[model samples]
Structure formats: structure tokens, C-alpha cells
Target: MSELLNTSEVFASDPSGLLRGLHRQPVLAVLRVSERQQAQHQLNLLVEAGLRHVELAVALTPAWVELAIELRQSFPSLRLGAASVRCLKGLAAAQSAGLDYVVSPILEPDLLAKAQQAGITLIPGVYTPSEVARAQALGAPAVKLFPASSLGPSYWNSLAGPLSPLPYCIAAGGLSALDARLWLESGVDAVALGGSLFETSQGPQQPLQLRPGLTALLAWLEQRANGDLLSG
Candidate 1:
């Protein structure tokens, strides 16, 4: 379980194995919403389409939090977490809503410590090697690279030399579903995709849907997990 994160293998320092589920199906769906009902329907579509890990950004109402907790209970295979968790208030809301994990857009040691005390896994955001090192020192189980699409998929590969055994990494922000294969192949533990996954010829940030493109991406990932596709 402590093997280095290869193409399909998992993390080296995941002692609690909180990320084992992600290793099997390596995409993190991050939903940003302004409507509660829309968020619920979107989440239903994702889980119904067999996507396992989904993060409901706190943009939705706290009522959405209740719905998320309920949906997670209904779908035992689903790993639901809170996104944009930057403060103790968000942490309290997630805790009350019964979220399994929380992700932040910045690395705040105080928030990380608070989450740790509450017995929750906090995956902090980081950009530089120093921030990643700081997160690891803060006892983070994983780290999310914010604005990752701007950095490109090859970014993690460059860090492999400097960081050696990189912390379990999740690439988030501005990533489209089409880039999943590229990022996964480039060695990120997971890619947190947003509504950009549904981007069309019209423009970006379309409503979430299980398009043929996304279905194909999910199929490809499953095949990779089953060893039918090339690991590298």
C-alpha cells in the first residue's frame, strides 16, 4: 500500500489508506454550483454514471451539504468530500454535514491542524515545491495543485526529480475531461475536474452532463485500471 504512485499504483505515505478508493478510479469531480437543485441533479448524474469521487464546493447552500451527506449514504461506493474549505466555518459545516474529507485552495497550517484535531483528512492546495514540503510537514495526507491546467500536465513530472517521493497529488482548476489521460499519464495521483469537463464549441463552464466524451474518458480510465491499456 506504500508503493510509489506509478501509472496505476497509489501513494507511498498514505498510512491510513484514505486514498485507496481514488487509486482505483483516479478522477476527482469538483462541482461548482449556484443552485441547490442543480447541484443535486449533477451529483446524481455523476454517481449514476459510475464516477466515485466527487467534491461539492461550498458554493451550494448548506442545504446542499445535507443533500450531499444523504446522497453519500445512499451510494456506498461514492466518496463525497467538501471543496473550497478555507476556514473553520467550512470545516464545521462539512463536519456537521458528515463529509468524509475536505480540500482547500490554499495551504493554511492552522486549518490543517484544526482538521487533524477533528479527525478529518485535509488535502491542502500547493503550488511550489516549498509549499508541498510545508504541507507534508503539516501532516497532510495529500496535496492539491491549484490552477494546475495553467501549469500543464508535465508539471508533476518535473517535480519528481526535486521532491523525490512526491506527496499524493491531485491536480485541480481549469482542467477538462479530455486532459484526464494526459494528466494521469503524466503521473498525478488524480485530476479534479470541474464543469469544464462539459466544455463545448460554445464555450467553457457548461452545465455538468455525462457526455459521450466523458463516458469515453471514464471507460478509458477503467480499462487502464484493469491493465487493458498501457500504464504509461
Candidate 2:
């Protein structure tokens, strides 16, 4: 197996650069599949949707590692990462599968240490100052503001004063086009869309049609990027 890059090394390697590229487009589809076949199908749809980054939740059975490995090999340019990785085992599995990064729903110092030691990017989840502080202490490259909707954009805006120097922040959870502009305006590095982007009907095999909602969301992001709505 190839040696995994530690957290610091991964950050130095410009993991955020990869994220910035993905953000420039508009959306990143986070797929949480329970089956390998379904995961593969979702991967194809994401690619078709013009999304270059994906987060595969590790909580899925049969393991998303297998699918992640296959996709990494097939789409070398695609940024494949693991989410819901709360334990060392999950971290190891993600690294072994050649994941570009690992995201957790909560902060875990040991897991962060392991990821750093192994040389892999880590995006620990944070919903409070203490969690953000813990993640920063671990030298996390970025922190995912999970269940972002609960706290709203103001929460992120508040963090900017103290955590401004910290690595990037991504907002996830209950995110939609209506709120995306506000989140970005609040200083998030990027946003991850789950249920808002994928419907159960659009199962693994079915391709995602660029629906009005999705298109509107994309348009809003684009407008923000162009400085039409977002001020710098």
C-alpha cells in the first residue's frame, strides 16, 4: 500500500486548493450509500452533475472503501473523500482505500492524530467554539460545520472574529440554494449538499437531471462567485 500523507502534509499539499476548485463550479454532492452498486451509481451521477468532489459516508455497510478505491482509480481527477469517520478503524480504512480526506461528524483527537500521522486530510465536525478549538488544536486542515442549518449563517459569521486564522470551514446539513448564498457570505470555504441534491427516487442507477432547484442553486453560487451578489 502507498504511504498515506499525514494531516499537515495533506494540508500543505493544498487540499483546500482542491476544494476551492470544486467550489468554483457551485456544488459538491455528498453521497451516503448503503451498497457498493448504489455508491457507484451515485458517483456516476455526481460526475454527470459536474461535481468533481464527493464525500462517501463510512457508516454504510459492506463499506464505502471498496467503492471509493474503485472511483479513485477510475476518476483520478475526482476528489474522493470519506465522511462519518469517527473511529481509528474507519480512518485506517479510508486511508487504505486511498481517500483524499476524511470527515467526521464529531471531533476525535485520536482519530485526528492518526490521520495526521498517516498523512491524510481531516475535516472534523464542529458545532461550537470548544469543538472548533479542539479541531484547531489537532491542526485540522478544515472543519465541517455540521448540521449547519441549526446554527444558521450567523454562527459562522461569529466564528470569523476568533477562528479567522484557522483552516477553512465548510457548512453542511439542511443546506439549500436559498441558504447557500448566506452561508458563503458568512465565510464558509465550501458547502456540502446531501438530501437537498439527491432524492430517493434518483437511486444509484438513475442519473440526476439538472432540475430547476439544482440549477437555481448552481446559478446562485455562480453569481456569488462572479461578485454579482456576494461582496468579495
The lDDT of each candidate is 0.76, 0.71
Q: Which lDDT tens digits does candidate 2 get at residues 129-208?
A: 88887887777777888999999887876766776555567789889755676677666767888877755465656654
What's model 2's lDDT at 110? 88
Q: What digit string (tens of lDDT, one per residue) describes model 1 on residues 1-232?
A: 1243453332323422458777778788887655556667777777776788888787445776777667667667777788999998888878887886889999999998888778787889999889988987877888999989778888887988778778888999888777777887887888898867543434445654565556677888888788834654
- Cα TM-score of candidate 1: 0.83
Which 10-residue window of candidate 1 scores lowest in summed lDDT? Answer: 7-16
Query: Quick one: best lDDT, which candidate?
Result: 1
- Backbone clash tally (model 2): 5
- Which residue pairs in candidate 1 collide? none
Model 2, position 184, has a per-residue lDDT of 75
